[model samples]
Target: MQKLRQETQGFGQAVPPAQSAELIHTNTISRGTKFGFLGPAVISLAVIGLAPLAFAIWTSLYNYNLTKLASMRFIGLANYANVFSDSAFWQAMGRTFTLLIIALPVQIAVGMGIALLLHRPGIGFLKTITRLSLVIPMATTYAVVGLLGQVMFNLKYGVVNQLLGFTGVSPINWLGVPEFAFATIIFWDIWQWTPFCALVFLAGLTTVPPEVEEAARLETKNWWTILRNVQLPFLIPGLTAVLILRTADTLKQFDMVFTMTRGGPGSSTELISLLIQRVGFRAFDQGLASAQAMVLLVITIVLSRLYIRFFYREV
Candidate 1:
């Protein structure tokens, strides 16, 4: 019994210590490898993203005007104070949010409808063709889209006006008028982005298990009921991704709007982004623009946090 016990103890002492040492060594190597792989990316982010952000914050503290570089002096929080007091800044912010409020829901609805249509079981070739068509708008660059909008929405020689002429309706100055111009911006955004949302939702739909869908259909012939109860759970992740991406994109929307309107028609489409551009470049008030940009950054972070906290769901 003593011999058996000693052998067991020896076995345990020898095997466990050796295995433990090997495991510890492996863990150290794993950690070192992970850090090694991550080092370059971390350095790049610090250099590219954090450095600029720090510079912007520093620049915001001064009365930096490009026109009067020699007169540039530190003004502390005065630029931020000016931003809050500026009516134009507030108006621009209002216009920005108004676009987001009006456009997001329309895009989601239209995109979801398109996704549902595409999700229906159909001829394989036709489905491929239809799905490929959704990529057309998404593949177009922002600048190209803006240029296309100019040609399509032109007052006289535009395709839109030509179509209106068929019904004996007068050519509407789509981009020249303030109200129509804003609507045109919304329309262009919708046209460009709806396909993206549709594709995302379609991917989500594809994840629905065949057995689960079959069981769901057996329980109810109502498509809405099946979609709500059986399929929506699978869509949560995709929906979250779409919401985050679209929200960020819309908040920073500059290129297309810049090309299309240049905040024209008497500042009608002067969104916050355009306001920042005008202040920074046109007015050459670098400090105020930096302050405005920092404020926008804060707003974006807060809104993103709100979306993640309230709507994000794992599936």
Candidate 2:
């Protein structure tokens, strides 16, 4: 027994122990290594990231007029007060969140389904074609999508009505009415962004082992069963990433909606972005705009941080 113990000790000493402190330390990187050199780079990025935000906070407290920079006065919380009091600002914010409620789930589900289809083997050409189609919409300029959407929804001669005309249904105003305009923006969002969500899920799907999928096939189950049991667990990380990204992007959306509807009809579809732009540039109310922008920035940051922390902790 003593001899056997000695041999085991020798073997253990030759190989690093599971709980060894030295084994826990990864890599043998030197102090002079390139990664070590990134200390300065990290500091630079920290400064860059925080500087503008600090400036915005400072400016939010002051009355900053680009035309009269010298005339700027320190008016703490007044701008913030005005923004809170503005009924239009609240209305626009309500509409923005409403859009998110309508669009996020559909985007995620449809995108995941598409990604699943693309993951199947022996369909290389189909995957390529589908990816190309999805990429085109995402790559299209925001302004161009807005313009095209307007053209397609034109009340006078819109393609939407032409299609409905074939079904003997009355012509529907796609953008002229408040509800229709709101729905139009939501549809545009789904069209342009579902591809991005799908791309993320597709990226995740590629990392899944083929053997696992083959095993799932051997179970003699339907497609939905395989997807629910096999695919979804693997896609948790990717879905978390997509949700966080889409949430942030949807909240800050400006160019597409403004160009398409410009907060039209009665402020039914007016988003917080349009409201901030109006206060900042159009009305020359920089202080109020900055305050509103700060409010928006805070909301997004809080929500994103919470999402990352809670759902995407590993992300």
Candidate 3:
């Protein structure tokens, strides 16, 4: 073995052939091990995620109405085209996006502030308590949350209007008014999502190497400078993740707005989802409902792809 190694390296160099052979054998086995090792995960993902997506696409092509079974017809791209002409569908798409725009920035800002406060070394106990407290809202069921939102925004006896009444302010129809109704939904979404974003920021903070933060503090006492230059840079990837996740979630805002207003007081706060439900079930226009859904699906897919490409491509 020594002679074989010497011959392969140089006249004076020596190594065992057995060690070289073992290394080569290990490399060969690893190289030949197919990623078929991921078979289960791939299969599970397809069954749970991809299969449903394919099924939705197929259903979108057909007039799959829940009520009028005889009226259901295979309509090809007719539903897809009808989406463009449907004013209600477009309005809903707008509402969903408007909520996203209002919620994402505010939630991200609040979450980062909390995470920054929590990341401080002196506030360990406070951090633990605050984090646990925030988790409660998240743990609460959506239905319950919606119910609470409705009660809170109630024009007559709701606590919010009651609080305003204390200051001699008129008890506005909080849920009935379009402006404040929209605002109410935005607030509810932010309250629920901010903590989640903070959790992401906290994860990013933990990964910042200790020595780097220490060196920054040593150089200067300017907290803002150090945070922007050091911590914020390190947190960009995490920030992107939080933004994308929250944006996607906000697009699906339904129960809170639905339970509170039923898209009433003049359809001012009516969203596409609620519109589709009304058409499909209430109005009994299944084809129109299907078309609206297809449009929604298309918009969601387009935006999701854009976010992935713009922010999460490297990840």
Give the best candidate by TM-score.
Answer: 1
* Candidate achieving the largest lDDT: 1
The all-Cα superposition gives candidate 1 an RMSD in Å to the true structure of: 6.2
lDDT of 2 by residue, 1-315 (tens): 344334445544432344443442323233345456887887788799778677778888989877778889999999899888989888888989999988999999899888878887787888798989989888999878888888888887989888988999888888999999999999999999999999999998877788898998999679888877887777778887887888888888888888888878778778999888887888877878889989999899898888778776543
Number of colliding residue pairs in model 1:
0
lDDT assessment of candidate 3 = 0.77
Candidates 2 and 3 compared: the better one by TM-score is 2
For residue 208, what is the lDDT in candidate 3?
83
* Candidate ranking (lDDT, best to worst): 1, 2, 3
Q: TM-score for each prediction?
A: 0.90, 0.82, 0.81
What residue pairs clash in candidate 2, if any at all? Answer: none
The lDDT values for all models are: 0.87, 0.82, 0.77
Looking at candidate 2, the ten consecutive residues that score lowest on lDDT are 21-30
What TM-score, to 2 decimals, does candidate 3 have? 0.81
lDDT of 3 by residue, 52-90 (tens): 767667766777777777777788977778778777677
* Model 1 pairs in collision: none
Output the worst ten-in-a-row residue range by lDDT, candidate 3.
25-34
Query: What lDDT, from 0 to 1, does candidate 1 have?
Result: 0.87
